[model samples]
Target chain A: MKTICIMCPVGCSLNVYEKNGEVIVEGNSCPRGEAYGKTEFVNPSRVVTTTKRSGAFSYSLKTDKPVPKTMIFKVMEKIKKTPLKELDVGDVFIKNILKTGANIIVTGKLTI
Target chain B: MSSFYDVIVIGGGPSGMQAAIEAKKEGAKVLILECNDSLGGILNQCIHNGFGLRQFKEELTGPEFAYKQYSEVKKLKIPSVFGAYVTKIEGEKITALVRGKEKEYFSKAIVLATGARERTAGEIKLAGDRGAGIYTAGTAQKMINYYGKLSGKRVVILGSGDIGLIMARRMTLEGAKVLKILEIMPSSSGLRRNIRQCVEDFEIPLEFSHTVTRVVGRERVKGVYYAEVDENLKPKLETEKFLECDCLLLSVGLIPENTLLSEVEKNIKKQIIVNEFRQTSIKNLFISGNSLHIHDLADNASEEGAIAGRSAALFARGALEELGEEYEISFSSAISYTVPQRVSGCGSFKIFFRAKQNFLRKKIVVRCEGEEIASKFCVGITSGEMQEIEVESGKVKGPLTVSIE
Candidate 1:
């Protein structure tokens, strides 16, 4: 498994190899890199955004923070229930929606 | 006649001072031409904390941060002429024309660090009269913090940028009543922490998606008409409303000072374009700081100044190669723009970019010819705070594309 650690400006190339149900990683200089690799490889999570049926049009809603590396697909299911109002870019959906108490923020502008 | 040095730096602001210091460290004699009587640029007027957090690891006010750099210049003993306005720079030798009360000087390698100017109310074409109460946020800050004069008793800030927000808090602390902060965009353009501290903590009402449509007053500002924007950012008719305020502060934006560049007039579109090395089209000329482009923070400007300074020194030593034509820089994905459009492919390079908007745990993948070369993720990136990615030599081979995802 391999991933890029988006911790800061020093984007180190990260490579993760697994053996005997265990993972070993190399090439990252930061502790965040190691944590990202292990979490991403084991349960891959991401912040997700989707549109919900609103009164006039679609309302784009998203989790305020990153979720379990594996729950990205399931969270999208939950987000489909909330209709996104005509929100501008960078609007917060929730302070902490991950349930784990981590904050996920919006990444793009709402075109509609 | 004007005298010449190896490098001539314009503007004695932090960027200009730092550039001169860096050039001196590289064994190059440098001259800094400052237009003001003092060396500190905007920092002299900005007396707030939240500076020197990244650079010094300790928080300091703007003036204190500037004094540290000023002391470094003194230690290095870099030569500079204060109260000197650089009128122009010309030719292969990079002769610069500057005027002072008594004398003028010319130099070899010219560096434009003229900094930037605040965008006035007239430029934005806001429907209003030339009232006495309207002022740019920076001007208001200078008046209050530098001259100890209050422009108005009550204020309605028209922009939510760092300066405006800080002014809001400053005014609140000074016993002035803040009517509201009208921001056109939905999100504050200032740092997140600033929004928390200045607006949220101070109990200032920050109205997003709102803009001032017209100003109402003849002799002085009596009120301002504002409204919320629709999905297309058109002011919603139903949302129109008027608020009473004596002062209107425009924190809209800042424009780079490029009048001197036009005197010598080189190939440029919006601003004087430079390559990754911070070198301009002319061989012996360089530009950095606000003169090159607007940066969010002062520390970033200092870093750019260092790069331009060091590169100018290399050019003076005659060890620098002609910046190659093969490697060009392009911005895509989530980047607003990248400085130094081309890297000479000769040395380690630093690339600076501003995100189009905020990001959440996204990776910035640097690609060459559609192949991934380097990628890094940021916990979050914003348009206000620039993100700098340094690429060592050999990692980049061809043209580069940065995508944030």
Candidate 2:
């Protein structure tokens, strides 16, 4: 399978395939790209970034770590239903959300 | 408050904050004036990760990168006034309205870090009635990421810029059905990583060589008439089709906001022309960041701001010296405009530009006086991303021309 590495803006085109009981990855400029190719070929995950509303203010939040790609909408559904209170930037809104081992933390400031 | 300073930086975005930090490091009294109440500017609403890679050597989200810089400015004790709308810039004097009252400030040197604005629907001359559901990509981003409000239930994005692609995913994640992304060009103009992670990840349809010929709605967008275009970018009447979309988002392009410098200088591209030091034609007036030229990354803007800040401080201290004769940096037709339109006395300086088209394993060569000064082989260079090349300055006798082969 051919895919583009999203590790950075470089976006190295990577070729990931299984051959003879071994997985092979090629066309990466860096080791991170190679890792991304391998992981993506196996089980894909992504760090989701979005906003959560509390009162009249909205604060940008993101998963503290990458979660399984298949469970993205489920995580988003949890984020939408989760009620947020007065919080500052860097504050955690949800802990280990959906057993994904990723906490939802605020990335934006709360402006009234 | 003292009405005078050694240096005054306008716009407290990433570039403005970096400029203020660098100026303060030079032991110059610097003040930052921001129109918004916060310092982050657009980075506040950009919740995505991928920033701070070049600057901090770590992948950080926009807000994370912004807060890091803002903390530095705070640590330096650089005084900044938010909600200060600058009205005029006459020489080294700046007039702004702070809390509805006009205030004047004087400085020996000034750095204009005012950023860029998005191209609107009217700017692109979209055939549409005055609608309520149309928004620029940045505006939609601000609404979704800042206000946590979805713009529409069904979205149709025009132009394949990075913002449009990011919004496509954001809207989808928010439960909005992004019908499709239409690009007038034959290929996507956004970064390949964005195309992979944002659009392709969600299985969103991206149609190239297609564009909305007319907007079909009143009061609020209900749908749009789109068609495939030929090589000349002319829409084929026979290929016209309609798509049901409640909202249309445009991610066309950005124009540098240099309205304050209208009396000082003018460029058809709306970008401020500056030298290697980021100094404009007017002495002691420096410009950086998007006001000078659109930068693909915030890290480059901060780097440019640092140069401009240092130069502004030196100019304020009356220690800046002339750097010999200036030579225009020319480029071939295959290349787009080069920043620092002119170069003056440099040991080794970087020139940033964009290619007109995609090229793989091409050589970017810089020549001065018919002598090849520098050349580097680039891999998979695309017009979507900006490219920078370093040139070792010699006693330049003629125009420096940069070409790709």
TM-score of every prediction relative to native: 0.75, 0.97
Q: What's the TM for model 2? A: 0.97
The residue-by-residue lDDT of candidate 1 on B150-186, one tens digit each, is 7888899998888898888767655588889999988
- Model 1 stretches astray by more than 4 angstroms: A1-112, B92-104, B263-269
Quality class of the docking in candidate 1, CAPRI style: incorrect
Model 1 chain B lowest lDDT segment of ten: B92-101
Q: Residues A10-43, candidate 1, lDDT per residue (tens digit)?
A: 3445788898989877877867668767766676
Clash pairs of candidate 2? Answer: none
Model 2 stretches astray by more than 4 angstroms: B266-270, B393-398
Best by lDDT: 2
Candidate 1 chain A, poorest ten consecutive residues by summed lDDT: A103-112
RMSD of each: 15.5, 1.5
Model 2, residue B144: C-alpha shift (Å): 1.6
DockQ of each: 0.02, 0.79
Q: Interface RMSD of every candidate?
A: 19.1, 1.1
